[model samples]
Target: MANVLVCIKRVPDLGGEIRLTADAMGVDDSSLGHTVSPHEEAAVELAIQTAKDTGGEATVLTLGSEDAVEQLRNALALGCTGAVLVEADAAAYGPADVAAAVADVVRDHEAAGTSYDLVLVGNDASDTGDFQVGVRLSYLLDRPVVAGVSTLSVDGGEVTARGGSPDGGTEVYQVALPAVLTVMEGGVEPRYPSIPGRMKAKKIAIDRVTPTGEPQGSGRRRLTLPPAQPSQVTVLGEGPEAAGAVVDLLESLGVTR
Candidate 1:
């Protein structure tokens, strides 16, 4: 049976306005809610579905603070068979470091007689926007890597990953087993955890591991929030005169013939 590993990140909910920290080095999540990154949520769903289809095992992994276990448990509630937490301060590590740490966990698990057949990750973390983790982890694991994958399936030890092309067509890649894929959102709708699922997840033990080595270096100086876009409201004439202005605006916007 195929063993799939889906990596997730705990990030501030992006549904609200985002603000930077005092030093502008990170997000000001103090006033925001937290959840798994949207793309990673899809990855988790894909992993669970694949495992269910193949009669395999789906494991969720995360690298973050102890509190991040909440995110891991959320995956369990969604039907992952197991969970792992590489306990660390996510903000202190860069993409390379996170990749290395995750690679270490995969190796350890494999050595312990659980070799993963597939590894799924989000295309990029919501907060950091770093897109290198999946590729770096694949390189470290000596496996084929597919990024921006929207759909995937496994057959006879092969994985078919489909993604979008610039020309609006689909790009499909068939790779051997034990591959890595960076999943994007919109491939499938993530299911909500039921009350019973949450209760079971709360009882599941999360395997926690400490990172083996220090971060090599992030090469990041600081974060800068984008400036807000300027907006203006034009005053058209009152009553009937406004209709002509509205029509003119619609035509200018190419909304009218």
Candidate 2:
């Protein structure tokens, strides 16, 4: 049976307008809501389904504040068997630091007789947009790695991954077991937790660990939000006289020969 690990992040919900901090170093989440990143949600779903198919267990892990337990529990509600929380201020750590802490957890788990057959992570975190954690973790763990995977399946100790190519085609990769995969959104449809699932998740205790190590410097000075795009509308005449204007518009748009 395959043992799977899915890593997730708690990010500000982007359903509303995003506001930045005064120094532009981070998002102003005081007025915003929080949820798991979209890609990570799909990763969690994929892990749970894989475990169910392979007759194994799915475990969710995250590196963030104690409040991140909410997200871990959410994963459990979606059918994860258990969860682990590496408690720390997520904002204080860079991609390398996060990767190191996750790697440490994986090693510890493996030493304790629970070697993971697959480790899943989002292609990038929604808030930080950092894409290094999965690759860094693979390097640290000496495992094969694949990124931007939109579909995944395992059979006979091999994993088949499929991703979209820029050329409007598909790119496929077949990697051995015990690999790391960075999942993108649209990989799988995430399930909503039912009332019974929520109750079960609330009763499950999360395994908490305090990450011990110095964080690596990211060398990032600050963050900057992009300016909003401006839109414009053109008005034509309002009558039969507008016929000529319509023709001109169609010509300009190359819709008319």
Candidate 3:
């Protein structure tokens, strides 16, 4: 059975209005809820299924503030067997810093005699749109890596991954074990947490580790949100009195005589 590790990130929920921090260095999510980054959610699902099908186990890991445990627990609720929290103030982390943290965790885990045969990651961070973590981690680990993979299947020590190509056709690769893969969202649908699953997840002890690697410099000076488009609406009468206005509106659109 192969052991798999999936790296995930916690990002603010984008369901509501998106605003930047007062300093313009980050998202103004103080008033919004947080969720697992979309593609990473799919990576979590893929890791679970990979472990199950191969008689292995899926471990989820994240690097961020203590609050990131919420996202970790959510992944656990979705069926990950273990969770690791590399607690740090990630407000200033760039893609390189995040990658260094992850690489350190992989090496530490391997040194502890827990070898992960497969490493899964999201194609990019939804909030910052940073896409280099997976590639950088692979370089650190000196392992082959693939990004934007939609689906994959493991057989023995080899994995067959499939995704879109630059030519707009499908691309497939047979990568050996001990490789890293960055997953995209279109391949797998993440499952919701069941009541029992949530209960179990609450009781599971999370492994916390301090980062041994120093963070790379902050990658951004500030953020700027796009200008909101002005919305215009005409009042059509509120009741029977508005019927005439509706007719006039339809007539203006050439839909009525």
Q: Could you say which candidate leads in TM-score?
A: 1
Cα lDDT over the full model 3: 0.89
Instruction: Kindly report which residue stretches of model 1 are placed more than 4 angstroms away from their true locations once superposed.
Output: 228-231, 234-245, 252-254
lDDT of candidate 2 over 98-180, digit per residue (tens): 99999999999999989899999999998788898999999999999999988888897999999889998889999999999
Q: TM-scores of all models?
A: 0.92, 0.89, 0.89
Query: Model 1 over residues 47-95: C-alpha lDDT tens digits?
Result: 9989998989999999999989889999999999899999898888999
Ranking by TM-score: 1, 3, 2
Stretches > 4 Å off in candidate 2: 227-257
Model 1 CA lDDT for position 98: 95
Q: Tell me the tens digit of each residue's lDDT in model 3 across 1-257.
A: 88999999888988747888788888888888898788898899999999999999899999889999999999989899899999998876788888888888889989999999889999988887778889999999999999999888999999999888999888999999899999989878888989999999998899999987567766677788889877687677688989888888888899874
For candidate 1, the clash count comes to 0
Error of 3 at 190 (Å): 1.3
Model 2: worst 10 consecutive residues (lDDT sum): 225-234
Instruction: Please give the distance, in angstroms, between residue 17's alpha carbon in candidate 1 and its true position after superposition.
Output: 2.4
